[model samples]
Target: MFTVIEEQEQRLLEIRRALHRHPELAYQEKQTSALIGKELDRLGISYAAGLAGGTGIRAELGKGTGPCVALRADMDALPVLEETGLDFASQQSGVMHACGHDGHTAMLLGAAELLARSTVLDEIGGRAALLFQPAEEAGNGAEAMIADNCLQDVEMIFCGHIDTHHPVGHLAVDQGLICSYADPFLIEICGRGGHAARPHEAVDAVVVGASLVLNIQTMVSRMINPARPGVITVGRIAAGAVHNVIAGRAVLEGTIRSTHPDTREQIIRRMQGVVRGLEEMCRAEISFTLHRGLPAVVNDPVSCALARQAAREVVGADQVISQGFPSLGGEDFSFYQQKIPGTMIRFGAAKDPSAGPAHSGSFDFDEKVLACGSRWLATVAVYGLRYLQKS
Candidate 1:
């Protein structure tokens, strides 16, 4: 049944590899966007490019006009050097698709081509939107797309991340939240400078910052509900210019994620409280700012049911999994759900067990899922379009 899909996706995979070779960062995916546009055009589908406040591209198909089912893929790479020794490994230094966004883009582009050529899809009252977005790594891309009305007519959205954590060709679908709200924060503490020998002369912003970092952990361990999941970690700290002298300024940066918004608010409030407490204790002034990243990735229940049916059609029911809960990971795709019903499926990227997981820079995905992901996305759009028609 998927033989034609396999043949068509092989070409799509060639396109994916070409992208992998020349990885681009957030907001700078001109070539990548252009490639997607060209492919959609070749498939006889019309598209819009330079969208969503960045290098966003989109394509539309079918005339039934039921509901617009948007299939989205990110068009950005991470700032990591590629160590994978594939023939098409990233030539761009310090930027690679270590997170499998390259595969995501290819899969969705493949789906666009498949749907463009599918009579069954069009017969189901299909109206599809293909979104090629940028700045997902930087966290502002989705907001840019939303601001541009990317979700105006979208009835439902479907997206997937390559999961090296799961076995090859295994698809994971879940109802409700599948990922957490990741927000990065920066804190600046100001204090009096002094010589190292004179501990009392300086307000010791470093000490205050250290105290705040330690106390911040309590928000998750002590304050937040034990049953609910939450995480707080300080990733970086820059203070004191010299080892022998106490610097007047210090910085603390980290991220906080949780399943619930109230819990997130509590964590933020508690973190601020800790900083405020340290300020009073150390007599150091502090300023803090939390830049929004992504809201929790919540999979709509109705959309999830349809996804299960689609996955079963593509890879049998045994391949579909619905047992796990959401992770603390963040996804910009959540932005789509904010405007329309959506499900973020996890396509297994670890084809070989010997290979390590994603984000390792050396991590490589089981490209076999290229076929699986492509068909699954196409099927979901068909299901969503059909569901919209019935409603």
Candidate 2:
């Protein structure tokens, strides 16, 4: 086997197309996991299947010597209809790789191949752990994996997502706070149901829900610090079914997010207090449900420097730039960064220059970046392992 995996650039693209053709949704990546496991076995890398999270695969290259540097790639697809019209488009109807996870999986797999074939990696270096995780789009995958001891031997971890907004072959990230904390919340209001015409007879839950929304807006704007950043979006609202009847219950579903955990908690508490007050004033019952998706993802300073150095080697120095703005999007990789001094970077994967954006039905990324993504990840794993050993 040749170091650098001579035909890896081609392998990345081909694997991406294959995964695209057979996309699967979160927690149901049996075919995807099996395919990756087979490839890892073929490379002769020692691996463990069904560990850390739903259908996750872990493979280690080189002898168990120095601290391991982990590279992560999420394997779950999204619940969107494929309309890209590419030849290798998703075969699974109503489930597609709309989030570019297919690209991530392919890139990490390429890195694995490169590391496996590298004589330097096997003889003179430490181990590089390639993590193929499932269900990252849902945001619980990282934590579930950690709970199962995925990061036990990992001293540092790095993960990346394909961003449509950034240019191809470009990478962006802040030294800290790369992504936001995503917390889902729900509001339920119950009141008396009666004839629509009799205004005094019924406490309409629909009216109360409407008032609650307005109050929530006020709370976010007035109670939250103006300088601090946060988002309060109501994604769904349901109430009355018939036109003439007063509904007894109304439900509101939304999410809260922030760059800081304290800020996230403060905003959530204030939102609940506001909803409680509204229910009390309207004489209605209220309920809440929360599914904490991910905590904020922060990049370690030392890791950031290492990434920039690694990227600059693959691309020019001018191509590597520090990102000032932090994204409000959530990532399960946050769980890894929590314990390990990890850094999550962004890679350009947009397909069409005229493309609208990612996560849409027409989501796509340029296939050329596959080569760059693989090379960068492989180089980083190699360099990072060496860097750790030096320390």
Candidate 3:
């Protein structure tokens, strides 16, 4: 398997660079989706296009019957300008594959290239499903794909993310709570507007909003258990337009990330109490809107075992790591795991140890990870199917 991937290493590099040159945003991957389709066509891998808001593609390899395992890759870019000086850096201004989605997409395509030529699927009476999902950054792509029945008849699913923090060839395949549940919230405060000079006459929305932000920050420390990993971050705040006049309205946008459901609910309830108390004390109307986001990615132990087996085989036993701590970061891949047994491998792609993390303007990874990731995906798919058949 490694030899096959090595033979196509140059081809994979070209494909990843081609994708890196033209990054597309969530649900708007027209050219990216087209390119994937083109590659699938070349590999003679039949797939259905125009799904999941017209960007998700599902391709199948092997016989139509028997057990099936699926592998997924996200296709989307961040709204950040590129700063990497690489010749193949993103050509699209204010849009870059800063999070290694470009690498993820290319690796999945590389896996497709390998699986298309292999006979394991046929021998095991199984199939491999490849999903090129869009809008993972927007956090709804997985749901859209599921709505389109992308998980239909799929027994086990696997996906991977490029982790720049770890060296190339390492894979993190730990089971249970690998990622956090993300919940976004918006707080709007409405207060009486009056002359700035007459401080006694108006309720200052800015002051109330600022106080609310401070109070919300304390929820994690005061209300939620200190032992559990939880974060409440107010990322953006908007208030008065002018300096002289008292603002009538203010908006605060933030997110809540937690590992357990009890802790998440505890924070939400405490936030409501805090908002109510602040509103009563300041005589302002406060509205809190929390949008339920992706669930924590808790890998199934059985599925993770398959990933671990594949990772060990592809990159040796030492390169396969069992992560000790869960990430506060969220992933839409959790949506798929909610429906069926699934796990996500964090593939190490860091080319430089000091390089910036994902979503940074200069983020890039070692192209060598492409072959390793592809081999792991292909290997895991076959192993998952065999495991299912035996059970």
**Top candidate (lDDT):** 3
lDDT (10s digit) by residue, model 1, range 1-391:
2334456767967988999998899898988888887887788888778897658986788887667898888889888888878899998888898888888899888787777777866577668888888988888798888888777788898888888877777899898988999999999999999999998888888888888877887667888996778998788999887799988899988888888998888888888888788778888899889987789999888999999889889888888876386788888888888888899889976656555566677878888888788888888888888888889
- Judge candidate 3 at residue 116 and give its lDDT: 84
lDDT of 3 at 311: 91
Question: Against the hidden reference, what TM-scores do the models get?
Answer: 0.95, 0.94, 0.97
Question: Is candidate 1 or 3 superior in lDDT?
Answer: 3
Q: What C-alpha lDDT do the candidate models reach, one value each?
A: 0.84, 0.82, 0.90
Position 4, candidate 1: lDDT: 43
In candidate 2, how many Å is residue 334 off? 0.9
For candidate 2, the per-residue lDDT at 377 reads 88
- Model 2, global lDDT: 0.82
**lDDT tens string, model 2, 290-311?**
7776888888888888887778
State the lDDT at 149 in candidate 3: 97
Please name the candidate that would achieve the greatest TM-score relative to the true structure: 3
Candidate 2 regions off by >4 Å? Answer: 1-6
Off by over 4 Å in 1: 1-6, 351-356
